[model samples]
Target chain A: MASLIACPHCGPRPKEEFTVRGDAGITRPAPDAGEDAWYAYVYLRDNPRGRHREHWHHTSGCRRWLVVERDTMTHTIYTVADASAEGETA
Target chain B: MADFALLHRPALADAKSGSFGAPSTVKRITLAALPEGHVLHVLAARGSGDLQGLIPRIGDGTPHAARPYGPGQWFVIGDAPLSSAEIFGKTPILDGKASISDQGHGRVRIGINGAAVETVLAKGTAVDLALSNFPVGHSAMTLIGHISALLSRTGKESFELLVLRGFAESLWDELIQMSLEFGVDAHTGK
Candidate 1:
């Protein structure tokens, strides 16, 4: 697991302060979308091994939603940005 | 009406006090429970731009009166208690750009100071407490040993912690434990 996350607002902090929400790429399906689409949107997720973007909440710090791009295997963080700034917060 | 009235009590009334750990003079840490003063939480209205210049208008004109913990959020503190009307009176200072919520009854301040204050705080938090990285008057909302608290630098060797009322004692204990090596004198009065 990534040991530290450089919060865009609070700077570098230990990962223990954040709560991971997993898979920032997923989008909410429209209410009228098909059942399969809704099911996939609600429950399906990709367990990628390489670079991935995930939603993490700085629960104990600045309390901001951040999008963290990092590698699952190497645990090297590539980028950390405010989720709202990227227009990606759900 | 109920038979009993709600009695107000200080958060750390029963907290641990006195000295502990290795005896030392140069590295001794002083832990004090600051006065139960007014703590006002301010939040910027949506789309409100930088309030760096306007927020101080609500402060009590004391040094470090306005402490910003996050973007668009701040805690205006003072040593004097305030009434609800007094708190609301400062609303117009923001001119509708921000709102204030009274946190006086919910939060409390703890003062810790010593030559090794940074070293003791470092054991619990990851923030760089060096004077260069965290200058005086800078505040950061971070976890200190699983407890959420706002840490603020006040002087070369002194720092203050603003924590929720329910967790003040726990954090106090943890702070003492962290300073055991340097010896600590805790005063949980007033």
Candidate 2:
């Protein structure tokens, strides 16, 4: 199908050219962190039902890292940016 | 073969021809078939060293170009329409099940050439629209004026932009505006 997708770094592009990276705002726990943190980093996910963050790469264009805030239930995208606020919480 | 042959312009059946705008302005628009040729299907494997794995086999080996697309997917851009087996024969990483299809998508393609092409592009795109990162023979999917298009570096100061049919008119208008500052001209082709 010919679908239109927007790059968080570069902007809008054909869905064919850009590859979906995955859920965004995921941060790997420090190597020296506790087992609980490591487990969360490795297996746990927020999987929010509402608006969530995703990471995507402009595989065909800018090749920059991007963070996209979108609603999981609906395909409505709210914001696209370079950095996510995931780290600030910690 | 011909240098122009390197371009695979999908075959157009019953194409409607018209003046895009002004003198020296024309665009060949239609649904076309993918050019039949020796298609080279290059599929790289996943992981840290996967990109590196493709370098030694590509001749003159370069690793940096293939990194942005990420791992685990195939990067199919070539002249030869060989099967995945053939590509794998050339490079071992192309072993993944490769899916191939004819050209059926409605794409509005434009070949832009001029000294100020980059300048015109820079006005719309947020990507590092520099010639170096996007050098000749390299391509990326980025947005121009917030409109997404596949930007392929066909030559020095020349690029092939593929945009959706819906966005064609708006993109064309944007192109016209951008080209005015750089002495823009267009030609129609299938």
Candidate 3:
């Protein structure tokens, strides 16, 4: 496989330079949260017909965050951005 | 970007300003090369305040669109580097506990610019690429064909597409074919 990839956090990189984490948007239940909550976090999914968020790890590349959007049914990706780039203000 | 090294400059400068700024002058910049191992020490956040004003104060400040990720989360584009530090200084940050390593996995980045950018994207992407909803600055991640990538719209006719190393060549070919209708010129590196 190729080695360099664009840093999901940064941008434009080689594949060998990064690692692929699994899908994004994995939620965990709180310690006191009930089994219903845990079950929903693990098993249930919204699987919307429109935009969907997922996670990817650029393990080998620059250590930054990434948030991706793709169609739930079509698997078509629309865009990618630094998960941390969210502005601090309203 | 005939030279790969030139592509190191942010996509915003290329699309919006058309002139690259001095690397040292760049604020909120990430000045590290590709590391080895899987590095996951990343801190991400979203701001609910005036995105319009905050855009210029940080890095490039160019107006790019944004998108939703997870619950109550959005992936936006700005001149700021994605780190634990604060830029907007008003928005709240959400942190992840997972440990990430600096594994040098191969990757490649390509920018799609042209009036038909959305149309080209729609060829392989499933999301609605309408300008009204998916306007500039908006971003998201998902699979394009078999490749998992990060896509960000940095301008009205421009976007940044991040494809994994393993699928770089394949995705590049696909992008070339898709971009043919709009006339694309991709620069791998500076």
Candidate 4:
């Protein structure tokens, strides 16, 4: 069986309860920035190999958004935090 | 009052009795609807300092006793009308803390008890429901045949499942199919 993500609100639950939104930590360009920046923001993505930060929604459990730190190579979850608290997102 | 919608759900329109399995095998499993009652969601912000002062001896206890829901929340299930507002108004309730909402109408509760209930549940959920892992009074939000549900063990051999109203009948049917071999003692309020 795969590892479970310990939800801060619902305790340790299977990964199925969450839906990974996308890579976290990407900053949006300021409104006046060129179209190239917007293109990168919308389409381009870094498929990094390790120590990736991501955003996931606990759709089935607490219904809270979470920021998850995971390793892509091994699928190991480092930590999970409530998105509303940290106020950080990609 | 206990007119909470959590007490009932619309029955499956085309359920065929005795199709899954006959209730001939008895004593192995028992299923019933717990009494009708209101269910509320009381959430204390995670890391919010104190919950003690919030209830502050509501005559004896907060109208309905609370049960495990999430890390910062409790399900105030009761036979009486919800009293979450009386004790804690829209104010902060002390600090920038705690919130409560009536979940009665949006969810439905079903009780499953007897020896083989775990066996029936294990068919669907991956989480271990063994007594050693999930003892009495323990609760967790999990999936039951693909539907998100709150699973609470109320006694040595009893469990209460809270599922969204939309998925109640589907879960009920799936549970029945799973309990076919063990036999289900069907009760009211499906």
- Which candidate comes out best when scored by DockQ? 1
Better of 2 and 4 by DockQ: 4
Give residue A17's lDDT in candidate 3 (0 to 100): 34
Clashing pairs in 1: none
Better-scoring candidate (lDDT), 1 or 2 = 1
Q: How well docked is model 1, in DockQ terms?
A: 0.86
DockQ of 4: 0.54
Best of the candidates, lDDT: 1
Cα lDDT tens digits for candidate 2, B56-121: 343323322222232333233333345435544654343442322322234545556666667767
Backbone clash pairs in model 4 (N, Cα, C under 3 Å; residues 3+ apart or in different chains), count: 1
Global lDDT of each candidate: 0.94, 0.52, 0.47, 0.70
Range of the 10 consecutive residues with the lowest summed lDDT in candidate 4 chain B = B55-64
Quote the lDDT for A61 in model 2.
64
Listed models, DockQ each:
0.86, 0.18, 0.05, 0.54
Error of 2 at B122 (Å): 0.9
Ordered list by lDDT, greatest first: 1, 4, 2, 3
| Native contact fraction, candidates in order | 0.81, 0.27, 0.00, 0.54
- By DockQ, is 1 or 4 better? 1
Per-residue error at A69 for model 4, in Å?
A: 3.0
lDDT of 4 by residue, B21-87 (tens): 5555553566555544566677776678657546332222532255655556666665554445654
lDDT of 3 by residue, B1-190 (tens): 2455422332222221112222222121111111121211122333433233332222333344233323233333332334432432323232231112221133435566666667777877555668786667666665566566667666776767655556655676676666554454545433
lDDT of 1 by residue, A31-90 (tens): 999999999988889999999999999998888889999999999999999888997545
| TM-score attained by model 3 | 0.40
